[model samples]
Target: MCSVEGAKKLAAYQAVDNHIKSGYKIGIGSGSTVVYAVDRLAQRVENENINIICVPTSFQSRQLILKNNLTLSDLEVASQLDICIDGADEVDCNLNLIKGGGGCLLQEKIVASCSKELIVIADYTKNSSLLGQQYKKGIPIEVSPLAYVPIKKRLEQLYKGEAVLRMAVNKAGPVVTDNGNFVLDWKNFDQSLDWNKVNLDLIQWPGVIETGLFINMAKKAYFGMQDGSVKVQS
Candidate 1:
């Protein structure tokens, strides 16, 4: 039997197939869902001769490109990209996204912004009536390791919430991002959130390089729904 996750995965796979094409320099994204898209792209490459170079959002994403036999290129070399496809943790109606659940938000946003087109692929559960509804985790904010305490205090005083510094339990230290920064997992707000305003305010705080809230960036979003259907929003 096809599980619910499987159904959504299939939808994501199909959605990417419909978007990716020949003569396109692709941006491969991070996370588990993107893995399926990579696999599908590889299959197409094996069947047909296509000249495509993929830039990755993170180390893991780069490995996926290699493991799938897709040609890989550096972001510096290929300054322009035709399309970029990635998965989101949560997607609001306006296509605002909560990414970096995989801890690659900074790099992901950089690669996506450099591309001409960005296509977000996510499962049904990721879709939300509004931001902060589906994903309760306030937002993933990457900060300097030394600035964690001060930044956390500011987030609490200013944002009216506690910012939890994400710890690397396995490594017995702080979670280090691909850019050599630490992530603050801010959560548990005491009151209702004005997502648009809050997202903007958080980034203005000092010591914050970037936040995981991707607002008005995606050109197209492919939401994989239950019962094997897809919801498209532009």
Candidate 2:
């Protein structure tokens, strides 16, 4: 059986091979799965001599571009990206996703929204029939430090689920995002709820910056199967 990491690599490489074009501006997302995508992109730059500019979704993503020797550009210069390749914590049949598991949701969404096409790469484990089916980390919501408590209360009041502050694993207190914001993981949502409406409502909250629920955003997805094959969904 192909290992999970191998599956990630397979999906990443497949996405790059299929969607990447010469002289494209790419949005590199942040996650363990996206690491393979960055590596493959670097290899493509070297072997194919493709003139591509990579725009990072976070500080971590920028570092990956540097480490891999890929040409890095900012969103300011490339406002309209050709494609954005990203990893999701979970992806449904409709290609809607649960991102922000790596605390880079704000920038990821901004970059994805700016791109012409958003391509997701993941292992089969992330593919699900519904939003919360596979990923139990709940919907991550980025909020201002001053508004986290109120926003959490508001979300719980609206959704009837517990919206808990995400704490840092290696450090004390809540997890701070690349945007210097706090994250609230809202768990136990009704799996059957209309996520598009939910996402719209959540973002309307006073302190909410962004939500992990990426509604109607992804154009395509590549999932690596256990058999070392790839599944393309659009």
Candidate 3:
């Protein structure tokens, strides 16, 4: 049987192959799955001699661009992108996503919003009938470091779910985002709640920089199945 990592690679390669073009500005997303996308994009740049500029969504993504020898640019230089290829922690039937598992949602969402299209690449495990069905890590909310405690309290009050600070595995403190913000993972949200309203309300809270809830943002998704096949969702 093909491993889940293989599935991620399959989906990523397929998405890049299908969408990447010469002289186009691309948004490279951050995650394990997106590593394959960047690698494939670099291959295309070398083998096909394509002229492309890649805008990174995180520190890791920026390193990937440089390591792969791909042309690196910024959102300022390429304000509007042709396409943004990213991975999601979870994706629902309607294409709503739970991102930021890697702590890069702020830039990821910003880059995606500026793109003409957002294409998601993931393994089959990430596909779900609804949000919070597949991913149990909770919805990651980036917030100001100073307001972490207040934001956590407010989120718990609003959603009736526990919002815990995301701590670093190797460090003694919370996981700091590329933008130097903190993250709170909100667990146990009501499954049947309206996500659009929830997203709007969460973002309006003071100190909330962004939420992991990417509602109605994805234009398409490619999920690699266990059987070594790819599924296209739009």
Top lDDT: which candidate number?
Answer: 3
Give me the runs in candidate 3 sitting further than 4 Å from their true place: none
Model 2: residue 111 alpha-carbon error in angstroms: 0.5
Q: Which is better, 1 or 2, measured by lDDT?
A: 2
lDDT of each: 0.83, 0.93, 0.94
- List model 1 lDDT by residue over 65-165, tens digit each: 99988899978899799888899988877778889888999999999988898898887778887766778866799998888889999888877667888
Please report the TM-score between candidate 2 and the true structure.
0.98
Comparing candidate 1 with candidate 3, which one achieves the higher lDDT?
A: 3
Kindly report which residue stretches of model 1 are placed more than 4 angstroms away from their true locations once superposed: 190-196
Write candidate 2's Cα lDDT for 1-234 as tens digits. Answer: 889999999999999999999989999998998999999998988898999999999999999999999999998899999999999999998888999998999999999999999999999999999988989988899999999988888778878879999999999888999889999998988889998988888888789999999999999999999999999999
lDDT of 3 by residue, 10-34 (tens): 9999999999889899999999999
Per-candidate TM-scores read 0.92, 0.98, 0.98
